[model samples]
Target: MSRITALTPDQVPAESKSTLDAFTKNIGFTPNMMTAFAKSPIAFNAWATLLGSMSKALDVKTRDSIGLAVSEVNGCNYCLTVHSFTAEHMAKLPADEIILARKGHATEPKRDAAVQFAKKVIETRGNVGDADLKAVRDAGYTDANIMEIVALVAMYSLTNFFNNVFDHEKDFPAVTPAGAI
Candidate 1:
């Protein structure tokens, strides 16, 4: 593995120029994980697009559950940090609820179903049996809702797995000591 270097604008390839520029303007900086990923713009673009589409399609409730489940399973420090915050802050999920979801003990009927279904999706590698599908449907998720979960798992899995393999460090400096990721 190459020594993972922090990417500065001077290091970005031409292919990554526009995307990183747009990202810097929005978030105040290009995310370090993405800057590392921009080494291959195709992969970076794929990651960006997949995460965006999945984010737009997912219900906030389902997204938090899925985020907790996949991050736990992947043991991805970077994702666990960001998604936990997003789950708590953006999704407005209670901290206790996210804790429960991480432990597979979420009590809310819909959320428990989402977490369980997401765990099964990762464990089964998309060969998720009918029983799992039936359970999610019974939990009040429509087929479209369930499909959004499939996309969520796949997209997060890509980033989670990448972060692990590439030694991608956390982007946000503010949360490092908590070890939440």
Candidate 2:
């Protein structure tokens, strides 16, 4: 059971209702995380705005890669499962690649750099060393891309922390972490 009540669209505060409805229209259902976030209108709106803007910053695969890597490192199963579904379906990443991303890797060199950077950001709490910054830039990412990568790390970290605290029931297909029985 979730520590926080996951609000339905009608049950959410008036300010959050439109956001939930938009989610329903776009995705065919409001994600559990969004519904849980609806419990606080300020949080829900902030998340929606940040996520909407960030979606344009990176390619879908890279975004999902960052989400997967961060969620795995944070041990947030709710985010892991949701991002796994998006990575495979929406982002069109292969299943094997999705698994690799969850482990903070990618077969593609540039993507691997992004995933590794995201993992390191979480592990070091954003106090990355100079070499870490160089690795990502050396992989062909521009300064803007690096900033986006950091923003994605921050974005996914927020959701991961929220899910970890609430233990919200996952509405998506379950994805066991690599090495889990």
Candidate 3:
């Protein structure tokens, strides 16, 4: 059970109505997280903007990989389930790759670098050493990619922390943690 109650569209603040509608129209239903976020319009709007902006940053596979890595590191089952579903259905990443990403690994070498870098950002709280920086650069990621990777990590970390704190009920199909069945 969720620690907080999820708001329906009619129950949410007026400012959050449009954003909630968009989510409903796009995904065919409002995510429980969005409903929970609706308790504060400022948080809802800010999160919507952050997610929209970051959607353009990296390829689907890379973005999903970062989400999976961050979610796993944060131990956010809610985010892990949502991202695992998106990674497979929307991003077309194979099941094996999705599992690897959740484990903070990647099959593709370049993507592996991004995943590892994201994991480091979470584990070290953005205090990565020189070698960590060089590894992604050596894998052919430009400065812009590096910045976006950091941004992605920050964004996912916010959601992970939110869901973990709230213990939000999972709306999507459940996903086990990386090592579990």
Candidate 4:
């Protein structure tokens, strides 16, 4: 159960009610995290806006893949579960690919580099060595792509830490991590 109570649309402030409604209309339910964010509409709007902007930085598949990989590393069951569903359904990743992604790998070399880099950022706390930088670049990721990955890492980390800390209730089909990498 969520340590933080999830607010229904009727319960949140007016500014956040529409966003909660749209979430329900689009996804069929309000994610518990959003319900937590409903406590502060400013936080909700900031997260929503950042999510929109960060989403454009990478393809859906790559973004979802990174989410899975990072959640695995962080041991965030909520993220693992939600991201598994999103990766499979919205991103249209195959089951095998989803499993591979959680291990920081991909069928495509460029995407593999990206996931691996994301993993390194989390594992090393963003203190990657020069060789780490060279590997991603060698795979054709430009400086901009690298920065985007870092931004995505930060974004995913925020949600992962939030869910983990709050013990947020899982609203989607549950998906457990295979084990730590």
Candidate 5:
């Protein structure tokens, strides 16, 4: 059960009706987080726009990796489950790689750097050291890429915090974080 009740399908605001319906058509349901966002059209649109813009940034695999790392760091089961499903189905990442990503690692060097940087950003609260930036740059990421990395962290962190605070019921296949028993 959620701490704050999410509006039912029929109660979704007009501004997000079509989009939520599209999500329902594509995935068989509107995600709980989105239903909660529907309570605030501005919040819903901001998240949707940020998500849309990210489609042009890093590859899905990299974004999924960062999302997994942020979810783990924040201990958000909702995000952990959602990102796990997206990582495997949408990103087509290998099982082993998804496990690695939850631990803030990647088999690929460049992605590893980005994932590690994302973890650092969360651990340090955006106070990453000089060597942190240099390490990612040495891995062939430009300043623009770093900016996207930060954005991905911010984006995932936003959802992680929201879902954890709201206690949104899991709508996807549940994935326990690595250390959970």
Candidate 6:
């Protein structure tokens, strides 16, 4: 592994410090991923706000399911662990369902659709066809929800690529380590 930088709030630029400060107060600490994001506060804030808004606007389980599917497909352990925590603790998705999604299984109709759609979107890389969207719609998502699904995929993709490139070791539970992907 490349010698990893210990990113901290104090080490961040002032504008990033303020944004990360809000995260620290709300979550007790800023995620290591966010500190990595401190490299460009303008981009970080935009991503953070979009991610936050998506979380708030959707059913938490749906959001987490899509996120998990994307991360798992992308092999992003950092994104996986963070969203897995959210899925289990905040979203309250069943553990079995989370496991199912992780392995590309559809545990139920609704979850299956979300995970399947996310997988297709990620695998196809924006080349998803109308049938994919139709399946997502048939699964009870609206056009707006479909957009959020895309957003989740995009968000996970961005973070995963960044983390993998920098070897952004996971902090929570520290399940992920310095070994390169």
What are the RMSDs of all candidates, in order? 3.2, 1.6, 1.4, 1.5, 1.5, 3.2
Native-to-model Cα distance after best TM-score fit, residue 46 in candidate 3, in Å: 0.7
Most accurate candidate by lDDT: 3
Report the error of model 4 at residue 95, Å: 0.9
Candidate 5 achieves a global lDDT of 0.87
For candidate 5, lDDT tens digit of each residue in 35-123?
88778887877887888798788899999999999899898988888899889888999988988998999999999999999999987
Best first by lDDT, ranked:
3, 2, 5, 4, 1, 6
Error of 2 at 151 (Å): 0.7
> How many steric overlaps are in each model, in order?
1, 0, 0, 0, 0, 0
Name the regions of candidate 1 deviating beyond 4 angstroms: 1-3, 25-28, 173-181
Give me the runs in candidate 2 sitting further than 4 Å from their true place. Answer: 178-181
Model 6, 57-104: lDDT tens per residue? 567776677777777778777777777777777778777777666665
- In the range 1-181, model 2's lDDT, one tens digit per residue, is 8898766546889998888889878777778888888888899899999999999987889899989998988889998888898888789999899888988999989999999998999989989999999999999999999999999999998998999999888788988853461
List, residue by residue over 146-176, the lDDT tens digit for candidate 4: 9999999989888889888888867899665
Tell me the deviation in Å of residue 169 in model 3. 1.4
Instruction: Give Cα-based local distance difference scores for all models.
Output: 0.75, 0.88, 0.89, 0.87, 0.87, 0.74
Q: Candidate 2 or 3, higher TM-score?
A: 3
Write the residue-wise lDDT of candidate 3 on 1-181 in tens digits: 8899777557889998888889878777778987888888898899999999999997989999999999988888999888988898889999889889987889999999999999999989999999999999999999999999999999998999999899887898888864463
After superposition, the stretches of candidate 4 with alpha carbons farther than 4 Å from their true spots are 178-181
TM-scores for the candidates? 0.82, 0.94, 0.94, 0.94, 0.94, 0.84
Tens digits of lDDT, candidate 1, 1-181: 3348867778888987777777677667667777888889898777777766776775786777677778777777677767777777678888777766666546778778878988888877888889989998998988888888788888888887887787665665333221242
> What's model 2's lDDT at 151?
95
